[model samples]
Target: MNLTRTWIALIALSAGSTALAASGLTGRAFALAVLALAWVKAELILRRYLHLARVPAIARGFSLGLAIFLMLAAGLALIPA
Candidate 1:
């Protein structure tokens, strides 16, 4: 609920993801899923920690940026180029 707990949860999620990647399950689909989760985490931070919802425009912009970055990075990583 609070920022600290949210951060801790995010860290835990990331660590778990890293462990999964290390376990030889690394695939583009899984990585894309992780990126989606990253976007969710970012939105949570903006809403819960930054109180972005208090300012609708800022909230939208911040979340949009987060989504864009996640999608782009994850998509690129998923590519075999």
Candidate 2:
């Protein structure tokens, strides 16, 4: 994607996440959606902003780690009241 497009996407994602937060979603659904958003945002940063895409191997490794960490975090957040 073009740099301009990437920036636009980042802005849009940030706004979308903010809207999701303000929508008052609760429980597991909310936790999962928010965590997924976090992953997307992190991926965008790592790829476009950090230029990690230049090294496919490192990018894959980092993405795997980020995914695992976020999934665990989301799971913990969704645990009962």
Candidate 3:
């Protein structure tokens, strides 16, 4: 992917995620949505920017790590106060 396009996508994704959050979404819905969007952004960065696609193992490792972290965060946020 072109570096310029990748950067543009990253910026767009970031803006969209922020807009989603600013829309006043609350609770688990918001956390899940944001986490999902963040995952997309991370994948984009890892694959396009970091060229992790060349190393499938590393890519999967990074993605799995991110997924686990996000799931934990969501779980904690969704738990009763």
Candidate 4:
């Protein structure tokens, strides 16, 4: 719950998410994997660093929007020529 632990959680989340994305996963599978990782990270931040049990709905909405954009962009890039 300390700052040090929060930083470590963030790093671990980044590594785990990136590894999953690089492991030949695709489509909704990949998106869900990344979203799951993000949730893990968010939980840590909200509980430890933010100490904010009640995050604003706008923050969650923005996070969801970003995730959707990333998934859409990746899907488009993977389209056949």
* Model 2 residue pairs with clashes: none
lDDT of 3: 0.88
TM-score versus the correct structure, for each prediction: 0.69, 0.89, 0.84, 0.59
- The true-versus-predicted C-alpha distance at residue 29 of model 4, in Å, is 1.4
Model 1 lDDT per residue over 10-70, tens place: 8887887787677776678778767776777778778988888789998988877887888
What is the per-residue lDDT of model 2 for residues 1-81, given as tens digits with 9 covering 90 to 100? Answer: 867888999899889889998999978888888888879989999998889999999999999999899988987997888
List per-candidate RMSD values in Å. Answer: 2.5, 1.2, 1.4, 4.8
Whichever of 3 and 4 has more lDDT, that candidate is: 3
What are the runs in model 1 whose C-alpha is more than 4 Å off? 1-23
**Candidate 3 clash total?**
0
Flag the better candidate by TM-score, 2 or 4.
2
Q: What is the TM-score of candidate 2?
A: 0.89
The predicted structure with the larger TM-score, 3 or 4, is 3
Worst 10 residues of 2 by lDDT: 29-38
Model 3 error, position 71 (Å): 1.3
Model 2 spans with C-alpha error above 4 angstroms: none
State the displacement of the C-alpha of residue 77, model 1, in Å, after optimal TM-score superposition.
Answer: 2.1
